[model samples]
Target: MGIKSSLSKVFASFVLKKIESWKFNAVDAQERTLQKLIAEAKNTVFGADHHFHDIKNYQDFKERVPIRDYEDLRPYIERVVEGEPDILWKNKPQYFAKTSGTTSGVKYIPISKESMPEHIKAARNALLTYIHETGNAKFVDGKMIFLQGSPVLTEKHGIKIGRLSGIVAHLVPAYLQKNRMPSYETNCIEDWEQKVEAIVGETLHEDMRLISGIPPWVQMYFDKLSEKSGGKTIKDIFKNFELFVYGGVNFEPYRAKIEASIGKKIAAIETYPASEGFIAYQDSQTEKGLLLLADAGMFYEFVPADEYYNDKPTRLSLGEVEIDKNYALILNTNAGLWGYSIGDTVKFISLNPYKIMVTGRIKHFISAFGEHVIGEEVEHALLSVANEEGVEITEFTVAPQVNPAESELPYHEWFVEFSKAPQDLAAFSLKVDLALQQKNIYYFDLIEGNILQPLKIRTLAKDAFVNYMKAQGKLGGQNKVPRLSNDRKIAEGLKDYIK
Candidate 1:
């Protein structure tokens, strides 16, 4: 192995030692982490305002700080954006990772110096953890492509503003930067179609062994690579390609297409990184869910998903989390976010290791008729129907059709973009409706009682989702279709693109 590979091995070995131990006592690790965070920020304006010094433990901290959403914290974030120091964090934030969340239009999340290292380390360990668990390090010896947003940053107020991906590009270690593909200039190309072509031109002949990005964008890269290489599979062109590092959206919907594009089955790693903080990663090769970071300079709280919309929901710490129950995630991180609801819903599959699978988003759900269908249920239903019917659905969105003028009874409306359309479209729609009915009893009751009509499904033209996202100017990098919406907004918007 080369010097860089050798160094990586050493670091992985050292970090894995702690990870192994922490899995046995994640509660203790979480407690210690919370204490450390409180101690570190005790003197900051937010800390003092919340009486952080008076807090002794988790209970005290929780009692002092009420759970807050982005809207509740907007005043503080605005202050920080105006170049205010020590307003929320101990120091002035170096950058703001801008993201358009489902509920919030454009959010400027602070990225502090203290939080930056934590983000970087968690991401590094995610890859290293995969390597340690699987003993697959060859990808490190060759070039890797990280399909992120532009590395070019724009100054906002006094701090730099850019997509989280772009901000992270500059933080990648210099050694790996040497082997990273797609020139910096090409990455900054505003038009995604133009950028993909630029990437294809530059990396067509390079030794690309690893690729990382959100699944949709990476699939675009894989498609471009295949097109440029004259129908050769990615494996055929980059003979050494091994690992696909992906997150930002669930990979199930695109798995068939991605595997088909790659021309072979390859190992995939999932991460739970957000503009708020680096939360979790897949640490075990065989395990089902991501292992939540216990000592990662962040404190976590879980509000039961069902109670999330309530005026006063029950919030629990790491020790109180239960297996199989969906909870809306709340984070108190080193980035100066205190009791911030990041809007993500998760379900823990393993308590010992604190492994969780992201279930959905708080704002992204369909409960117009009290069916309360979530992203997790929609994803599960989609997977079941896809597997049973042997179809490939690239992207999909669901919204409630509640207008009596349009339909006799209220029903769910589904708009699907299929790369490989099913031959029997009616049968496919029936299967989707049946799967959702089976998964959600309330939905089933609504249909059985004739209170709501059967779910409506419409297949969209290929690239319909791409076109829709492009029209919204959010076609790439962490932007994804919100699986469920309360009204017919998404479905109505997509109607114009129906085939």
Candidate 2:
């Protein structure tokens, strides 16, 4: 191993020990974080308006702050964007993470100086934790590539504004600077397709070991590499490539196809990151869930997913969360977000160290006929069946086909892009439907009551999703198709690409 790799193992060991010290006291660490956040921003406008001075405990906070989405918090965010100081948090925010919002259009999530380090630290710790557990720091000596947005930033009222990944690109640790791939000039390319092409050209022969991105984009790069290299597997192109780091979407759906592209099983780490905060990461290769970052500069609250739309949903602290129940995640961050609902639903699988799995989006579900099916359920159902049948799915989405052609029973329409089609598609669909019914009782009841028929799969053309996203001008960089939708907007758009 090189000097850098040898020293990285030492640093990884130290970081792992520090993480171990606090992970066991997760609940207490969360309490301390809440207290510190309140103390630091007490005099700020939002803090004062929300009675932060009078806040004494989690109860006080629950009573004072109401759960809000981006639309609800737009007024305060507008003030900040218009150069208002101390409106949300103490002083001015260093940057705004610009993201596309469904209802609010453009969302500018503040990234305060105090909170910025948390994002960097959590990401670093994820890798370090891997190295500490596996005793594999040799990847640090090889080229690493993170498929991401351009590092270019725009100014909104003197605060830098850009995508979270783009902003993070500017903050790559100095130690990894030399090992990071896809030259800065190539990284700055605006178009994603062009960027990938440029990246392929630059890193094709490099000693790449660590590759990170949302799954689909990485797949795109791999596809291009394969095409350029006369159908060679990714493992052939980069023999040293060992780790795959991914987030933003469930990796299960793409796992088979991605592994096929790589030509082998490889070490992978899952992460749960968002514009709001770095929430969790896979702490152990053997563990089932991502470890919630309890000591990160954020306090978490959970409202049971079923109760999320209710006027008075039960807002529970970290300590109150139960295993296996889906909860709408709420955040109170040092970045000045108070009781902010990032619209994600998560299920706690482990409580000892507080590990969770991203279940779905609160807004992203299919319930046209009152059979509320979530992202996780659909992904689980399809992936389960796919694995059993040895099938490879490229991408898929589910929407209720409430208005099927005359006299046909209503059913869920599954738009699936398959890399390897099942010989018995009807059988495959039946297995998937059965799996989904087992997971959701409502869906089972609906099917049994003749209210809904078994889901029908509509095979999509090659690169259908990519084309759909490209047509919508959201081809890359953290954008993903919703796994389930109540309405047929996406389902309709996908019709053009049907086989």
Candidate 3:
């Protein structure tokens, strides 16, 4: 093993001790983290207003600060952006991580130096924990290709503004940068297609042992490599490849295709990372859910998913949570975001180990006709059909057709881009419809009562979603197709390219 690999192994051994300790006592750890954050920021503008100094416990904290989304905290964020001091954090924010916004064009999230270590540490410990459990640290001896946004950051109000990946790229440790793939010039290419093509060229011959990216973009690179090299699989080009570390989106839908591209089975790691914070990661190979980082520099609160959209929601702490109940996550982070709704919904799969599976997003749902359908339900139904039919899905989205212009009732429209189209498309559609109906009673009722027409399917041409996203200037990285929309906006937008 190389010197770096040997040292990393030694460090991983040390971090394993910490992770094991934190895993079992998640509730206590989370309480302590919350206390620490309250104490540290007690004198800040927000803290003073919320009476943070007087807060003695989680109950006190909840009562003092109201749970808020980005819109609620926009005034404070604007102050910080205007170069105000001690607005949210103790110190001025050094950077802002730009991310996708719902109504707004872009969201600029504050990133302080104090909170940066948590992002770095959580990622490092996740890998170490994986190695500790699986005993698979050999990949550390070779190169790691991190497919991220351009490293060149854009500046706004004298603060660096860029995608989280790009910000993370600038923070890559010197030791690891030597082993990282793709030159700086290649990563700076703004167009995703051009950048990925250049990345394929630069890293195709390197001794790449580990690869990390959002699954769809990684799949694109894999396809490009296969086409250019005339090889059956990615393994043929990069023989030393061992691990695929992925985040941002679900990996199950892309798993079969990824494995097929590699031409062999390889170990994988999943991380729950977002612009708000690095929440959890897969800690053990045998574990079903990613272990939540309870002590990782953020205070967490949960509101039952159904109640999240209500005027006043019930907030529950880590100790108050139960397994299998979907909850929308609320975070108060070290980075100055107080009572921030991160918008993610999750369900605890393992209470003993404090592990969770991300279920969906709060804003991303379809409830056009009281048949509320979530991202998780959609994903599960699609995966179920894909598995049963022995086919692979490339991508898919669902939008409600609320009006029937012709001779039918309003119903859901499914636009699917299939990597391997099932031999019988109608049969596949029927299975999907049935699976969805079985999962959601309201949807089933709508179908049974004939108030809604049968779900319609439109098999999209190849790269249909990709072309759509590119046209919107959101082709890659953290950008993703909204899986479910309540209106016909997304469905009608995709109609032009429907086959």
Candidate 4:
């Protein structure tokens, strides 16, 4: 390690000691335990039996290894393509988490025995972080609703298996397990398409307190709740649900609408999670960014946002990264991924190496009209206007569409499900325009005052995301709308809903 990196570790140790002095926390001991675990992590990934054993330090590692996404593992995937068994991280791997992700085609990420701890550590510490920060033991007593995939058996793998949804479910303490609600699939829907239909139906009688998962799927449940209760909002069904923790998308876009329908500002929190690991989570719902689980069994490396796709992408270790700078992360974990480039981008929100705000995915950007548009700028612009207007939104998606019919301007449409209707639609639209114009100089210069079009926000008809999921055949498992889609296919799909 370099002098600066060494200095960062010393500072981290010192400050954490101070934090451990707080009345409710006991993490200083956990920090010492983590030091031992890190040594084990290095040994496991770099030991004689595994791959990439050469590098002893971060600087000695290659400046840029040939980048590969999940598709690059096709050769390894071919080994077990016919259910041949004993593939990556074998030992009769308990079960595979069937995550529904595709751009080119369907991707089945195999979560094996060795990789199991990665998810477990992530989920366990997620709660530990919440307790350390909030001092709330209510989570130990009350019902926690997991807005996630099914907990059913897998015939394909032929294992008495676990889903990603319930793998984390099995790791929690037995005390907390007693209070959990059975999955929506177990109680309500067996017909697959109707799984969402059942999960929402089963949640009707439960007193949900701390709910977790993506924003869109939760919205799908709330929409169903509204319909089943004769247009009554979800608050009507689960009257005592005070904590509303959501993530996996930009929460700011739908903040106003969700709040409006729910009758109060649901204590919300954001998280950054993946099949690889639960990377980061919010310690307090009121905090600005997620308090990253730094000591979790993963070594994180970040490549700057501007530098990600380059031949020599810059990589920063935990101690080397700075606040407010955007970086694409590389991973080395207990999960057997080394120097792995996970595709998400995050901006550090504070001096603490463990806290960050996920700004956007590095893949989700639009430059169709010579105006480069990214998720962070769009989120900032929308949040500025929404905060100003005092709007409460629960679900929304954004896109950049060139107006084929209208020659004057390229249109940026924000399809929103709103809590309140603004009396002056034009005024609200203009506010969104001003927020955008101030943030992007390319956009500002391209269309000065008159030429630039204002944003269009439209309220969904209760079950809009549900309708989208049904149309896309993504009604079950891990299906969520891309919070920002810059493609024409989705734009055409939303044309009727956009006003």
Model 4 lDDT per residue over 1-499, tens place: 3343244345444544544452122233334433443445443313333323454455644432344566665554444434655344333345555554555265445555655675665555555555555544444445777766555555464544445665566566554565676553462343444665676667777877776766666666676778777888767777767667666777767665566567677666566777666777776656677766555555577888888779777777666778888888766544444466667888888754357888777777655666666788877876777777776555557777576355666667777656555567678877876787798787787667544465666656555666666777776455656667667666567656544
**In candidate 3, residue 471 scores what lDDT?**
86
As for TM-score, the candidate ahead, 2 or 3, is 2
Comparing 1 and 2 by TM-score, which wins?
Answer: 2
The TM-score leader among the candidates is: 2
Candidate 2 wrongly placed segments (more than 4 Å) = none
The sequence of per-residue lDDT tens digits that candidate 2 reaches over residues 238-309 is 999999999999998999999999999999999998988999999999879999999999999999999999
lDDT order of candidates, best first? 2, 1, 3, 4
State in Å the error of residue 286, model 2.
Answer: 1.2
- Candidate 3 per-residue lDDT over residues 413-439, each given as its tens digit: 999888888999888888888899998
Q: Work out the TM-score per prediction.
A: 0.97, 0.99, 0.97, 0.79
User: What are the Cα lDDT values of the candidates?
Assistant: 0.88, 0.94, 0.87, 0.61
**Candidate 1 clashing pairs, residues 3+ apart or interchain:** none
Cα lDDT for residue 218, candidate 4: 64
Listing every candidate in turn, what is its Cα RMSD in Å to the true structure after a full C-alpha superposition? 1.6, 0.8, 1.4, 7.6
**2 or 4, which is superior by TM-score?**
2
Error of 1 at 304 (Å): 0.3
Error of 2 at 457 (Å): 0.6
Lowest summed lDDT across 10 adjacent residues in model 4 is found at: 22-31
